[model samples]
Target: MGIAGVLEDARPAAAMVVVEFIFSALQIFIKLALDDGMDVRVLVAYRLMFGAAFLCPVAFLIERKKRPPLTVKVVTGLFLCGLFGITINQNLIVLAIKLTNSTTIVTALSNLTPQSTFIVAILSRMETLKLKKPSGRAKLTGTLVGLGGAMLLTFYKGPEMKFLRNLGHTGLSHAQGSHQQLRPPPAEGSRILGSFLAITSCFSYAIWLTIQAKVGQVYPCHYSIAAMVCLFGAVQSTLLALCLHRDTDHWRLGLNIRLYSSAYAGIVASGSAFPLMSWCLRKKGPLYVAMFGPLIIVFVAVMSSIVLDENLHIGIVLGAVLIVAGLYMVLWGKAREEDEQEADEPKAKAVGQDEELGKETTAVNGES
Candidate 1:
């Protein structure tokens, strides 16, 4: 490949890394905003609504030519993607953050994405196992390591709870009013359970990505698909939020920093990120994008410690290292496999041509 080709190929990976990093940082900001008494359901609903409002026009303008016809199958796929990917995933994630520490949730959830994606891909017939292939073996090993790291992050509390006792004034004050007798201080066991729920949300998201890959193959328009999904998610989330909140005043919009934070998450994180992710996945494939999940975890851990006044524990650092190492091993094996396949293409073509020529010669001989 020429220098230009190399640069072109590098851009998508770079873009994905940047996007994921931004998303990681954005989580800290979201947590801060949520700390200001924003309801999780309300936050999720507004994010979906605002994201859809922002993305629809862009999709229509950019993907006007390649937009798929509005069929029942396409609509149903979009709705399902919206429900699981945006509505349930976002709500559960915000709930996890509210219920547990950001460091634990981020680390545990980050490692689960690849394992979930792998399992769903295999079950959906998107990927196969070939134990003889190095790529296959490496992928399987990497996935197991990733899963083990997730289990450790979610289940093991280590010898000490570094951040458990350090609940700041804000968290303490918030804890006092809501179920004071029933809810106690943040416990290691509860944090572990919250981490598990976050991981489950990651698995749900992985299913969404695998399904989106198939949808991309069929529809071929990333922006349009994203727009439709966001639209459906907004509708579903709004209804759910309404059902959860009885007082109409609780749903009213407020003009404050929280509102601005919601807009930022909606426009940049949900609206822009979702479509960008889909485009990257379509062009580069799922493994390429999924490989950056651990990178996001690291960024989130650092930013959360700094911005949210959370502690950086030794366990988090070790878990992050294991997760990133495992992710890169998987991605590296995949790259090598792709390179080998490319190199073998010409040999396979030549062999097929020779076999066809031999058959033609034999036929001529028999006829003569």
Candidate 2:
């Protein structure tokens, strides 16, 4: 392949890496916000609202001419998407971090996203698994390895990984202090609860990724669907928050980490990241997008140790190692699958597909 062809192939991968990095940073911010006593419900409500505000206008202007009609199926799918992706998924994530008193733990569990997605896809007949094929075996092995790592991460808390904690605390904790807990350590029950919540969140996220693919298949307007997701999530979560809290005190926006983190979550993380991920999902499929989950753990591990005074225990370090190993195995399998699929296709059709892919950047700016 030529330089342009290579760049085209690399673009989405690079975007996902950047998005995951942003996610790692956002985990730190949200942990800080939650530490400062921001309620998870309130945080989720405001985040979706902020995301809706940022994406609605952009989606409208960009997809104005070619936007598809909002069919009932698409609308219903979007509502569920918002619920799974934003409301339940995000709240569970924030609460998991708070309850566990450790961002790294929650992050480590996210490695299960791709594994869950793969299993769900197979059950739903969206994908097929052939044990005879090397690629299929690699994919299965990767999922099994990742699941084992997640189990280890959950059940075992070995020695603290002091090396990670000593990495970049000076910068992450400049506003606070060196190597300090964001709050008092939680009870054992809360940690277990948090681990369960984190696992649920990953499954919810996997379901969202699957639904998003289906939604995109029906309604190709990326930004519009993303905006709808945020808007619906905002409305749903806000109502839920109101039902629980009744008082408006928690809804008040203040000029603090809560507001900053919420805005960043909504605008940058959800608003910006969603459309990019949707594009990648359309291009490389859900498993490709989900594979990036393992990368987030490493980033969160370092950042959590520095910013949230989270200790990377032996379980975490070893689990992360296995997870990363599994990630690459899955990625390699996917790559081989794609290469074989292309080889099976007519050369002219492959060239045509590449041409369309070459238009990816322009399409991102134009369609989405």
**Alpha-carbon lDDT, every model:** 0.74, 0.83
User: For model 2, which pairs clash?
Assistant: none
- Superposed by TM-score, candidate 1 places the C-alpha of residue 290 at a distance from the truth, in angstroms, of 4.7
Candidate 2: count of backbone clashes, pairs at least 3 residues apart or interchain: 0
Every candidate's CA RMSD: 4.7, 10.1
After superposition, the stretches of candidate 2 with alpha carbons farther than 4 Å from their true spots are 1-14, 167-182, 275-293, 339-368
Q: Candidate 1, 99: how far from true, in Å?
A: 2.2
User: Best lDDT goes to which candidate?
Assistant: 2
lDDT of 2: 0.83
What lDDT does candidate 1 reach at residue 224?
87
User: Per-residue error at 203 for model 2, in Å?
Assistant: 1.4
Model 1 per-residue lDDT at 301 = 61
